[model samples]
Target: MSWLVDKDWWMKTYRGLIVKSMKLSFEMDQQATDLLSKMLDGRGNVIEFDEMKNLFKEYNESIVFGCGPSLLPDLDFLLESGNLRNKLLISADGATSVLINHDIIPHIVVTDLDGLIADIAWASLKGSVIVIHAHGDNIERIERFVPMFKGRLIGSTQVEPRPHVYNFGGFTDGDRGVFLSRTLGILRITLAGFDLNGEPYSCPGKLVPFNKRIKKKKLEVAKTLLKELVSKGVGFFNVRGEPYVL
Candidate 1:
């Protein structure tokens, strides 16, 4: 009886973990679906790229830039240096305009619209691909803008309501923009100004806060996923503190 009791407890605990993981994964999937639906309501489904063959095309030499405050100082230099204009640019959420203002158009923009509403008008105007990560909070926005976007919109889902956007219980989406770059099969990636620390950088009256704990973890998760891809000879780069391999 004692052994059976212990066995049952262990089984329950293991089952609980499995259940949690499944729940999170489902939630993430749903979030991605909702965001994609909004961004692509009229645009239609995103074309599935051939990850195997296409992965080698232009991405082998591509450089991906994540938007962060640290990037502000060197934004001009980076953009003007012309290191990655031909290479695919993956703009993280809220950084879309920053890149745009500098005339450094990202091939794709990633965000859940937390701080991107203001830029939506111009971004949509430029006709760049936007990947919107969906969450319950933004359903109304999705419903409203999906019809308006009328261009390339990719959606991402998430497992948990982002910590910043929870009240009692609900999910909040952030820029899983890096994922957009990956989906495009860009094996070579560069992450700049992606500092995880929460410091403040200013532009006009606005301040770009550090609060990248969430982003950091998300980026780490992305790195792990890319590792498997890299081992198979996929080219990869992490341009954070120093250029490193995935």
Candidate 2:
């Protein structure tokens, strides 16, 4: 994904130490990447880079929905705005549930195969292209779910780019969606359901078992990277009344 930002720039922007802090290893990340590549061999379901560009070619804007406290309110605001007509809907991992409950299947869903297997699978079945992120923690999950998606998915990673896994310049799913939009040449990106500075990242309480402190740090890393993008002139917007200022 050297379209919007080059791989070298991404390498210089984010650090592998951050990924390592999450207990994700380079070997494991590569394992996941190679697994996805092997599974995709001779398959016709590839979600190619050109396909991504085409997916946003006619759209005037794209919206990334995060699994934050303000997600519902932001969704309501977006729905009330009456602007769902030409916007590409991208949802972060757990945010897929929110969109699905609203009867709105996102155009693309970014996930690490952490939780909500049923929801992610359901979304894929409903014509939503899934962008699966791989790392040390999700190799098993990737093995379990990649075959099931049958080509309706794209692979991503934070460590490095392999034949299958493309390193988009974001750590978390939400910001990664933003990176995807920017890389695909989407002009305007509105972020909903992002609570960047809200209440200390308590949302992932019981769903996924990970250290909260480390997770909070990852969120901060995401925020910093996003601010950098904003400073660099990427069109990013936060929903009204949300804690996030981007």
Candidate 3:
């Protein structure tokens, strides 16, 4: 199938899924939905879709960095290659600190605010628009960190997108970055620090311990989601040193 055709079909399917999920959320967790709605009620400066579209208008390629153990190593190579300047840099939550520490500010940071709240805040302050996700599991996190962000802020939700919150169709921060890029019609996407088969590491900027089982599960989901995008004719490339299929 042609990419144009695939894009149309995938988007239609995606919207249908979002509608179904929203209906289910309302049915199964009305209270949680209500709580999230309230939390986002007074929030101003929410990013709009056209704003994001304009931000990426000039770019045809993007590189999304994940916080997997291999992120630093993979980033080192990309930095040396000097090709990063031509592509938008997107960091997935925990990877935000790594990029900042290396003196590279990501154009966008996607987070559930579970990783490195302070660093994510710093990045936001540095002009990196933060795409903050709000779900039932992270309501407290949202309440704690959303107010602390000092710069551009965008809200995302796993449920139905609301007045301020939008859904681009991804579960984890890394995949969300990819989803956002694809949604914006980026022609090519390169991934770094995404090692689904590598060793798990602790979430950056946090004292919480790492759970290999959970990390593995999330990686599986991320991989599946990315693969689905690829199957729908989106271009995805892995720049990790070691061979990574899919």
Model 3, position 239: C-alpha lDDT score: 67
Candidate that beats the other on TM-score, 2 or 3, i.e. the better one: 2
Which wins on lDDT, candidate 1 or candidate 2?
Answer: 2
Q: Could you give candidate 1's per-residue lDDT for residues 92-205 as a string of tens digits?
A: 656676777777666666655655555654676676666565654456666655556544554444432221111111112211444334444555556554543444332222
The segments of candidate 2 whose C-alpha lies over 4 angstroms from its true place after superposition are 1-4, 20-24, 202-207, 241-246
Candidate 3 Cα misplacement greater than 4 A, ranges: 1-37, 40-44, 207-209, 240-244
* Per-model C-alpha RMSD: 10.1, 2.6, 5.1
Supply the global lDDT for candidate 1.
0.47
Q: Against the true structure, whose TM-score is highest?
A: 2
Model 3: per-residue Cα lDDT over 75-139, one tens digit each: 88888888688888899999999999999999999987788888988998898988887766566
Whichever of 2 and 3 has more lDDT, that candidate is: 2
- Model 3 misses residue 26 by how many Å? 7.7
lDDT of 2 at 66: 86
> Candidate 2, residue 104: CA error in Å?
0.3
RMSD of candidate 2 to true structure, Å = 2.6
Pairs of residues clashing in candidate 1: 28-157, 28-158, 28-159, 31-157, 32-156, 32-157, 36-155, 161-171
Order the candidate numbers by TM-score, best to worst. Answer: 2, 3, 1
